[model samples]
Target chain A: MYERTIDDTVTTFGVSGKLWRDSMIMYDRATESLWSHITGECFRGAHEGAKLAVVPSTQTTWAEWRTHHPGSRILFKPGGKGEGSHYRRYFDDPARFGIHGRGIDDDRLAGKDLVLGVRFGDDRVAYPIAAFGDASVRNDSIAGVPVVLIYMKESEAVHVYERTADEKTVHFEPVIAENGLLMRDRETGSLWNPARGEGIEGPRAGNRLERIPATKIFWFAWQTFYPRSRIGGID
Target chain B: MTGTAVLFTLLLQASAPFERSQEVLMGDTLYSVLPLDAIPAIDEPQFVPVAVADTFLAPTEMIIGVSIDGDDRAYSAWQLDEHEIVNDVVGGVPIAVTW
Candidate 1:
């Protein structure tokens, strides 16, 4: 979720055994500073003012990932150490908030509701997981930059892309074709596959939409860090 | 200081009843939960081929997928829930895959 390189040097991180707003805090072995796992920013220690660069990632079903990246390497714990989960019970309880019993201060949505958050250049928005319903694609802008959000409900995947191509901003609508096409641009009628953002079969065939970094997270966690993040596309 | 100024304004507009003082995050805000590396990070991660992974990974289980500079990886949520972090080099870029 974050680039570990700092000042042209690679930094190794550890579980600091600390919690900030009920989230894990990682410590860099190089400086021993505690950094937020969610925000990637140092909150204490030698590197107090430093922050790690966020790397874009996707969250999806294992089957979907395998289908897309069959050659991809899978990270497994050595010798069966990673079999069980510590937070499985926590995940099952929608009423649970965090380590402490702190309730949500902002009632716009529930504390544990998952959301897809996108942030860049002074703009941040939290799209509730419930908003996607089944499969949905919508066009919107953040900080005045055109973008589209595509949610594949079955795969539990969400992707955001800048809908501009060849110096032109194009509006797109979701395609419900039986053959599994995802989007259609109003400008050129190019059908696009939201998963990869590539124009499938149309005037813009071979064109790809620039992907925007987004994260899937708990609403409480996202709100705790980005307290002012805008809530959109939620009922 | 533009980032700070913007953060200040955002904090002022925060709807949460909790007062998020930036000063506190630098002070007493962090609660020490356990000892250092109580939840150890996966340092030298080993990878399994898709065929090997399919035998264990559930079709419905969620995985964090990353593709950078032609190097693709899949980190299962189940493993991440336990380890919390995986420090790996992908496509010459060092990345920490944290849950």
Candidate 2:
């Protein structure tokens, strides 16, 4: 997701039916400049050097989203079929990663391994989704900063958060509660609601972990674009 | 994976839509084989309440959910597969919901 305004003017965008590193290239109606949908960078045209502001958003299942934002509205195409993906075949083909296939020289993970990519400052970390079960949580540190990753089985949405509350660090372990999957911090034995990033029980009640933006990405694409990214769960 | 990201990753790894010609910029393999608007964007998106959406959208269907300043909207994954992008305003911010 990106802000559409470029240099103080709002512009509309369209898919140019083009590719940049096998990623979709978007063009703005105002300048007709081509922009990389992956990086939100203008590659060609009047706004060649410009970029769209990255906006934080979540990708999840309708059921999960509806459960949380019960009153949320959804986009619909009129005079059209409801909703179904056109790339189901390609997505199922683990051997392929793009128009050119997985040509990146990294072998840390398979080309199609789905990962939750967390970016902190200039560095990024990847947590392989397959490493965890349907609903799971993991404690990790990014650049020495304590953090936690929560995976929602139903939605496959990964939520990341800074584990420091009140300048103190805490680690979490997944607990299978009757209601659903949740996290329990090791220090205070506080139960945490992953979706809300808050402490729901024990001594840490009412404490909230700072939310961190994470993107669900394929291993190959993340490697190709960010070679320096370290794969999590590798040890 | 969410439908939007599935579509996006597929776009990144699937075969090129059009024949590739040689071009390079910013360390990326570039191809402008197709003309502009080959896959039109939804400039004026129509939205419906969850009650209305539940009638059509599958429970497991993936969607991009954007919430800002208390205003929330979802872009269907299937809708993005065909259109690729949607220009809309959320939380008073003009934004492009791209695949």
TM-scores of all models?
0.56, 0.58
* Residue ranges of candidate 2 with Cα displaced over 4 Å: A83-233, B1-20
Model 1 Cα displacement at B71 (Å)? 0.8
Predicted structure 2: lDDT? 0.76
lDDT of 1: 0.74
How would you encode candidate 1's per-residue C-alpha lDDT over A1-235 as one tens digit per residue? 8899877888888887655543567888998888877557787787787888877788778889999898899986666543344333344466765544345667788876788888866887999878776548888888899998887654455678998988899988888888553899999998898878999889999999998767667787677768899997532
| Residue A234 error, candidate 1, Å | 3.3
For model 2, state the Cα shift of residue A203 in Å. Answer: 35
Which candidate achieves the best lDDT against the true structure? 2
Q: Candidate 1 at A59: error in angstroms?
A: 0.6
A1-235 in candidate 2: lDDT tens per residue? 8899999999999877665544567889998898877667787899887878977778778899999998898997777653233343344466765543447568889876888887777668888888877548888788788888888774455688999977988878888888667899888788999877988999988988898767667787777767888888722
* Candidate maximizing DockQ: 2
